[model samples]
Target: MLFIQHLIRLLAQKRNLTLLTLGVLAIILFFGLRPKTWPNINHAEWSPDTQGLMFHAPGFAYVDDLHTLHDRASDQSFSICLAVSSAKQLPGFRPILMFHNGSDESQLTIAQWETSIIVMNGNDYSYRLKLPRISSGDILLDGKPRYLGITTGDVGTQLFDNGTLIAEKKGLRLDIPTNEKKLRLILGNSPYGNHSWEGTLHYLAIYDKQLAPEEMAASCQLNDGIDRKNPLLLFTFLEGKGTEVQDQSGNDQPLLLPSRPMALKQTFLAPPWPNFTLSKTLLADIIINFLGFIPLGAALYARLRLSEAFSRWYPARATMIISFWISLSIEMAQGWLPNRSSTLLDLVLNTLGAILGVLVIKMSWNTMENMLSHANSATDLAK
Candidate 1:
């Protein structure tokens, strides 16, 4: 009882209260500011004997300044062929390859959701034309390498697994932008560093002309499997050891294997609202975010109320406002950290937690006063 009284009395002092708040803030920063491990290049490896790029976790290699190829491929028929082996099946969409229009807008994306392969064709207006999205069945999770290929012409698009026709859609075509903007090719991860594929990349080749099923199948049989005829882009991953993957198509566009994943430069202040999905992980994140700020709210409210620095209602309001600023600052910082998402949901939850803390301290104020009084009486008696 005496120890509790002493602790409470110290917290009520202005200097001690400031120290306590700073301590709590420090703890929050420590957890939120730590760099993500999966985005590091250490998670990726080059297999010399197998001549493949193995990604133990989410990582990426990118090819930049592809304006010439982007312009030619736009409004034209094309085919893409790649061989990949899934290390483990995950629930969310994992991007294996994406083409961006020199900016955040995506021109094309080939991703894996669970064991299914999904191919989306469009520029920034993809969400409007939802159909023609090719979502294949669970075929890549068998723990063995499989060759996946796609061809898109003016009529429709077709997907092939090991050269076998699996899924095809009409009225869907490769819609690369005709603009002269620079283009980027991201392999193994999304541009935002969110969707990361865990697998081994055997080979990836891009052709200007849509190839027939026989050609696509025949290409998979060869060692490199590149069409050998003027491919727009080809990555064989045969470097064995280097920070760069040679572009065998003679495009002179090399894929750079950076030590860290790419993160958005200016989105730290204003990230788009996170898409909420119901899952255990989501539930846990909500709980952690809400409960984390409770102590700050309670301590600030208590100190403000005890010091009589503000009116009766203002202390609670002030506590909430202060909590909001703190949470927002933290969220902004998280945006720069790889793999750490800066979401409005977390900010709102943390503010609500602060409110809860304020209520808790308000309700327990009388009890704390009584305990302090008893401790004082006991101290007087001993003297």
Candidate 2:
């Protein structure tokens, strides 16, 4: 008992150590317990060497590259080798090869669920024409206006998803002839901007031979479909994810890792924070940081019971009013400081922080006050 008392006294006397420990724990709780909301106030992050442009669908095992889009308004000729199979769904995009009627679209979305591709073109034209291979069916083209038409393209006949296009009729028709140039896919409003293309690609080939079925399956299985055969896409040996286990001892299986891209070299105004270094805008910096701190600040007020004391010092109703003014003052002052924004969002969050603080004070008041009151009474009795 004597030794325990001495240890407690020593801890109490070391104010600096106690304060440091408290601050560290508060920071950990602030970050670790945070909800999964993002664009968080993470101070330091490594930037990607080069920003990658890619698409990720919700459940599909493969990623489609936008770079493969082919575009030619009576100018460029394009060729792509593809294996058509059944495992892939409808409205599926062939890796973009030879594009037309795409000048205004930001991107194309393949809607397998609705058997459509949503083209978000700017609202200028009453109608626009799209061109793609014509497959079998008395096809119904429907959208904002919901129009129907027959379209055609030089195409092959047999292919399966998850199966390779083992063969094709030599010199199949793919491109529209100059005389029948009306073989165009069209979009218009009343029934415009949104439409469906439900059909199939017979086969895509590099040479005469069709790729093997297993090869097609493996290609679609990749996230990037990056060089699916010879040297498989893999994470680094240093990385923990996507690595294969060799033995019970947990050693590496001796696979060569690809070299990473060059690191992004940036000068940080605040060391370790490349993001903070980008903008010199004082007002913007203040606003951004103010929003960043609200949740942490609210947790602090809850732990410390600032609102309860303000109520005691003034009136019960003044709690919300007083808390808001104090929080707002801090946010406004941040304008004079570097790396901050004067955003309305920050003010909103700070006010919300105060409201949350007051709520915590009201919720815990009876229990905490009772505990403290009993402790005082016991001390007096002992004295």
Task: Choose the strongest candidate by lDDT.
Answer: 1
Model 2: per-residue Cα lDDT at residue 173: 28
Cα lDDT computed for each candidate against the true fold:
0.76, 0.30
The TM-score of candidate 1 is: 0.87
Off by over 4 Å in 2: 1-105, 111-299, 302-358, 365-367, 374-383
Residues 169-243, model 2: lDDT tens digits: 333323311212211112110111112122222222211122344544443331343453322112121223221
lDDT of 1 by residue, 166-260 (tens): 99988777665444767778777766665578888888888888888998886654375334667788788877888888888787988887777
True-structure RMSD for candidate 2: 18.2
State each model's C-alpha RMSD to the native: 3.7, 18.2
Pick out the ten consecutive residues of candidate 1 with the lowest summed lDDT.
Answer: 122-131
lDDT score of residue 82 within candidate 2 = 29
What are the models' TM-scores?
0.87, 0.26
- How many backbone clashes are present in model 2? 30
